[model samples]
Structure formats: C-alpha cells, structure tokens
Target: MSELTLAIDQSTQGTKILLVRQDGTIAYKITKNHQQIINPQGWISHDLTEIAANLKFLIRKALSHAGDAAIKAVTISNQRETAAAWSRRTSAPLALAIVWQDNRTTKVTEQPNIKKREKIIKYKTGLPLSPYFTASKFNWLQTYEPAVQTALSTGDLCLGTIDSWLLYLLSEGTYKTEPSNACRTQLMNIETCEWDPELCEIFGINPKNLPTIVDSDSNFGTTTLFGTLEKPIPITSILGDSQSALLAENCLHPGEIKVTFGTGSSIMMNTGQKLLRTKNGLNTSVAWKRKGKTTYALEGNVNYSGALISWLKDRLKLINDPAETDEMAQAASKNDTTFLIPAFSGMAAPYNKPELKAALVGMTPLTGRNEIVCAALDAIIYQINDIISLMCQVFTDSKLTLHVDGGMIANQYLMQRLADIVQCKVLISPIQELSGVGTSLNGMNNQTLTLSVSKTYKPCLDKIQSQNQVKIWANNIKQLTK
Candidate 1:
C-alpha cells in the first residue's frame, strides 16, 4: 500500500488541495476560488467561512478521486500576514478578516510614537512598522470594530493568521500557528521564535490573544475536516505560502533564491543561520524552524505581479484570458518604449513608496493592445528584478541559483524576458503547485525531494542594453512620483 498525504494551500486568491503519493507524484488535485470582498474603504478581505467551506469541499473532492490510498498526514500552506479575528466560544469571526494588502492602517503607522520607534521595532522583529503586516491589521480591527474590542476584553478573541483559523476549525479546537506564518504578524521575535511581550504591547495585542507558536513541521493537531476523510489525519505541517515554496525548491544553501509569482510576488534568499540586518527595505523573517533549530531568509515583496495581468483582462478588457497576454506580448514591437509601474496598492520593498500611484509611460503612435499587454508583462518582470537586485546586494556570492515557480511561469516569453532583465539564469520548477508540495514534504520525515529544472531561461540581452532599459523605467517612475 502506497502512503499518501493531503496538502491544502489556502492563498490570497483561492484554495488548492493535492493528494501526494509516496513516489513523489500528485495523485489528485482540486482548486476553488473564493470571493475577494473589496469595499468602498479600499480594504481587501476574505470570507473566512467561505474559505473554510471551500477547504472542506476541495478535500472531499480530492479524496473521492484518490481511491483507497493510505493517507499518512495533512499539511497546510496559507497566505501570510492576513489577520483573522474570531470568537473563542463559538468559533465565529467578529468581522471580515483584514487582508495583508489592505492599507487602512497606513495612518495608524504614521503616528508619532510608531514612527519614532521604527528602528527599535525593526531591530526586534526584523520587520518594519507598516500596515502590510498582520499586527497592524489586527490592531486596526481591534480599534475600529466594537465586537472585536468586546471579544478582546472578554478574553474570547482568538487573533491569528489563516493557518490558525483553519486548524482551529478543522481540529474543532486547536489554536496554534507555525513560525513561518507567525513571523509575519510583527509580534513574534525572529530570534526567540516566540511572541514578544514588548512588541505585543506596542501593537496593543495581549499575549493571551495570540496563538501559541510552533515549529513549521510540528503537529498542528488532528482533523477530519468535518468527516471528509475516513480517518483523522495528523495536521503535521503549516507554513506561509512563500516560505513553503522556498523549502519546496530546496533552497537551503545561503544565497540560493526562489521567486514565486502569484496574486503578488515574493523574492526570498536563504541567508543561512546568520540574520543579515539589511538597511534596505527588505525584510528578514524566520524561514522555518524544526526541532528548536531555526533558519532565516531575507524577503522583498511586490504588491502586484500576476494580479496586473488579471486587471488587464478583467478591468481593462484588453485580453479575454490571462494566457493570451503571452502571445500578445510576443507580438508587441520590440522597439516600443512603453513602461508600466504597477503601484495599484502602493509599492513595497526597496522602494517603500506607499503614496505613489501607478503609471504607464513612453507610449507612441504604434502603441496598441499588444504593446500594452507586453508592458503589463514587463512590469511584472521589472518589479521582480527590483527585489532580485536587493537580494543580490546582501548575498554578494559570485554564483547565485535562481529557481522560479508559480502559475505565471508557464509563459516562456515572460521567463526569458525576466532572465534577460535580471541578467541571471532562471530555472523553472516543473511543479506548478510548489506551496502545497512543500507543505506535504515538511510533514515527511527524512524525505528527500528530487527536483529537476524543467526549463532554463538565460539572459539574451547584453548588460549595457539591460542597464539602459532599467534606467529608462526608473526615470519614468521618478517623473510620476514627482
């Protein structure tokens, strides 16, 4: 009997469930998208109940296709930094979960005291005092929502990330989170791998309200997910989606990097054991912890990437489907000098400009749908290139291996363009669902992943041409910011 494991990936956009066999092959997979829940206040949210229902549905659907495979355990990879406020007694959410991308707390971080203590906060948590983190959103809810305040006062509030919410619902009562997700809350100390008392007080979050931190691969609890399976499986692993992909790519060595393009993009480099204190906007986070041993990573986040392509299709009506952008981009004139700065939700990492709006520059008479489509694709590449530049600054080692994964990597043209602009060899992972695969692998003891490069994109442009193009883009952005 071949052993199997179920891996659930609850992301910003949707939930995916995969049944992996012992032979390192996915026996079955199911995906379901949830509502985005945007409001007039420009806050982004997810229906936690809807997400949980979808999780149960995906698990039931995958298990039906999986036959009688002997399942070993279950693991989860979820969107990091999205905070959830729930009732401890009834397990009901107090309000819509505050998404990581929501900037409602921007004014909160600008307070004199917060601005004054930025250096101290960053030094302790390895994260800046920004609205992008979970603590800020958590604080926002506690401050604005009357129900959240009441729950917090009554000690019935369970403030946590998506992973903890799912674990609590699935296991019927286990309130816990792992380091990879906990580190993004801005309340956990990266060095101690525990909730910091002073930082909790800074955010006005009580330590009792936070979930107990655990190792990445530690048992989250046992769950049947509302009897979707024959037997309860140990919830063996939980990790933030990006960090899970880092492990899935097996980027263990210092200077090894993996870029995951999804709703947003995260460019992370393994800095080994030593925490590289970066003066740049890049963030240092606990990559993972196992058996009390921890590893660290330097990460840069871009608020827009593949989401830009979605906007072009859904909002602008430029393309009927996302995949069409690839061919349109290939058809675009190479000489056209159009550049798009996708600051839809403000810029993050390296730039740190939250007030800047997006811009499309250098259009000409020949600019059309194809050129615009190409510009969107180029925007994704350039945003990723910016983060890669920052990661390279810290890891100055001559040889750097770049591993690429995500749904967007299917575009060979875009991958080639990314390689050319970044001037690095880009290796595409054959697996599209690396986050789920990584979470499943985390649960396995002494299991070695055999990852092979499906395709390699090498730099096609000369260094001078690449430099000039980047300079042009930067100049255009500077004009817009002014």
Candidate 2:
C-alpha cells in the first residue's frame, strides 16, 4: 500500500481534508462547509459541534476514497485568532466560537483600563489593541458569558484558537497550540514565544486557561479519526493557515513574503529570527517554530477580501457565482469610476478602524452590475496594495516579490489587477490548498519540497494610470476616515 498524509484545514468558511502524496501533491480531497452563525447583534460565530462533526465526516469520506493507501500521518492548518472556550472536563463548548473578524469586542478594547495599557500591550504582543485578535474576544467571554464564567470558576475552562480546539478534540485531549496561532492571541509575548502574564491580565484572561505552546512541527499526538481510521495516525504538524501558505510558497528566507487571499487576507513577510516591531501599522508575530528555533514575521491583515465577493453573491445578489466575477470584471466599462471600500467587518491593519462602515463611492449613471462587480474585485487589490506599500517602506533596500496563494488567486482579472496596482510581479502557486499542502509537507518531513509556479502576473498598466487609480483610492479612504 502507498503511504499518504491526511491533512485537515479547518478554515473560517469550511473544513477540508486532503489525502496528500509524499511529493507534497494532493491525491484526493473533500470539503464540508460549516454554518457561519451571525447573531442579531452583528457578532459572528461558529458552532464548534457542527465543525467537529464536519471534520469527522470529511476524514471518513477522504479515507474511504484512499483505497489501498495507508495514512501514515496527519497535519492541521487552521484559521488564526478565532477564539473558543470549552469545558476541560466535559469537552462541550461553553459558547459559540468567536470569529476573528467579529468586531463585538471593540468596546472592550476601548475601555479605560485597556486603552491605558494599549502601548504596553502592543510592546508585548506586537499587535495593536483591536477587536481583530483573540484576547479581546476571550475577555468578552469572561465578562459576559455565564457558561464561560462557570467553567472558569470550576477550573474546567479551556481557551484556545481553532487549531488547539481541533487538536484537543482529535488527539486524545492534546490541548496545545503552535507559535503561529499562539502569537496571534495577543497573549503570547512575541519575543519569548510564551503566554505573557501581564498581557493575559490586561485582557482578563488567565494564562492557565490557555493552551500549552508547542513547535509548529511538534508531535501533536495520535488520532483515530474518532474511530473512522482502522488504526491511529500520528498528528505531526500544526500551523496557522497563512503561515502554512508561507511555507508552501517556499518563502523560507528573510525578506520573502506571501499573501493569502481567503475570506479575509493575511500578508506575511518572514523577518528571520529578529522580532522587528513596526510603528507603521504592521504587526509582528512568530512565523513558525521548528527545532527549538523561532522565526519571526511582519504581518498586515485585511478584514475583507474574498468575503467581499461572497457578499456580492449572497447579500446583494450581484453575481450568481464567484467564478462569474472574472468575466463580469472584464465586461465592465474601462471608463467606469466606481470604487468599493470593503470595510464590512471594519478596516484592518494600516487603518485599524473597527467602526468603519463599507462604502461604494464614485458610482455614476454608467455604472451597472458589471462595474460594481469590477469595483468589488478592485477593492481586494487596493487593500492589498495598502499593505504592500507599507512593507516596501519597511524594506526599502530589499527587492521583494509577492508570492500569493488562495481561492481568489484563481481569478485571472484579480491577479492581474493586483500586480498592476502593487506594481510588482505576482507569482501564483500551482496548488490551490497551499495550507493543507504545507502542513502535509511538514508531516512527511519533506524539508526540500519544491513548488513550481503555474502562472505569473506582471504589471501591465501604464505607470500614470496606476498612480492615478491609487490616488483615487487614497482620496476615498481619506474621505471615509475623516
């Protein structure tokens, strides 16, 4: 029987299982989307029970399709900063998991107590005081949720990000998280790579409630797929989705960067071992930890990218399918002046305004569905450009390339526009599930895994035109902020 690595990617939109070959290529895959529970208060959540069940279903489904292939190992890549609380004794969720994009904690972060220590918090965590992270969500739970309060009083509360939640459920109660996920919690000290007591206290979180920090490639434990597998498989690796994409893109050296365009987006630049904190809005985080050594990174987040496309289809019903966006954008009038500021979940990174609402600006009588669809796609590119511009400033002397992988990369129009706006070559990965491939590569111990780019998009727009478009985007942002 041939050997395969079973990789599970539990993301915001869904849970996916991939049967990966030794060569870091996917052999078989299946995806199961979970419910995105949005309450009346605009708080977004996920039912942990539904996600956990979906994962088991995908595992069984993937394994049944494996035929004679023996599953040698398992790995996981999960959405970062989405916090969950559960009972350590009973293992039932205390409440719905708080999604990273949920901005309900804006009030918590703005409190006099938290605002006074914002600088100190930033110094320790290398993240700004915002509702985009896990700490404030945990604080919200502690302050308001009765179930969480009861669990904590009984010393049975287990707080963690999605990776740890999945790890704990899958691996015989292995409650641990890797650096990439841990560092985003705003509880872990980026330099020390451990949960900070001061930071935890400030967020009203107990260090004892957090997961044990482990290496990205640590032996997470063994799992039997909750009895679906004939025998247990070693769970070998765990990484945040963006960090996994970074590894999959082969961005191992300093100054190398990768952008993951998912529901939201994460633009990460590997900064080697140095924890280079930025004053210009980029957050510092642990890229990954392996062999007892830590690699640091600088990151900028966008709260809406692919989600904007989803909004077009689901909310406004502008497009029937996300795939139709490419043609719709191409059909748009070249002279159309419509622009979309996708601040639905509030602006992230560089701006850090959770209260900001989305706006569709400069629409004229000539604007129609095609123009609006085109503008929605352009919004993704513009948000990315905002981050890449800041990164260029940080690494003025270094020549940087933008290596990108995600669902949105498949849009030819989007990729080309991204290159035109960022004014750099964008290399698109051949692999669609880079996160799953990355963790699977680690599980197989394939340090020399090579990735070949399927396509490359280079700047084609005239310099003056590109500059004029960016200036217009800047003016819209300024007007919105003012």
| Cα lDDT listed for each candidate | 0.86, 0.90
Cα distance off (Å), candidate 1, residue 277: 0.7
Q: Which candidate is the best by lDDT?
A: 2
- The residue pairs found clashing in candidate 1 are none
Estimate, for each residue in 1-482, the C-alpha lDDT of model 1 and write its tens digit. Answer: 77788888998899999998765568888899999888886778988889878887887888778776777888899999898999999888888998887887888788786778888789988887888888888888899999999998898999999999988888888999988899899899888899999888888889899889989989888987688666788998998999989988988778889999898888999888878888888899888897778989999998877778878988899999889988999999999988988887778887877767788888999899999999988888887787788778777972465799998999978899999999989999999899988888888862547898999999999989998888887787778877
- TM per candidate comes to 0.97, 0.98
- Over 1-482, each residue of candidate 2 has an lDDT whose tens digit, in order, gives 79999999999999999999998888999999998888888789999999988988888889899999899999999999998999898788999999999999999999999999999989998999999999999999988999999999989999999999998899868889989999999899988888998998898888889989988988999999898877888999999999888888888888898989898989988878878878988888888999789988889998888888889999999989899999999999999999998887789888888899999999998899999999999988888888878877886644567899999888999999988988889999888899999988866664645878889999999878898999999999999999
Alpha carbon deviation, residue 107, candidate 1 (Å): 1.2
- Please report the TM-score between candidate 1 and the true structure: 0.97
Error of 1 at 460 (Å): 0.9
- Overlapping backbone residue pairs in candidate 2 total 0
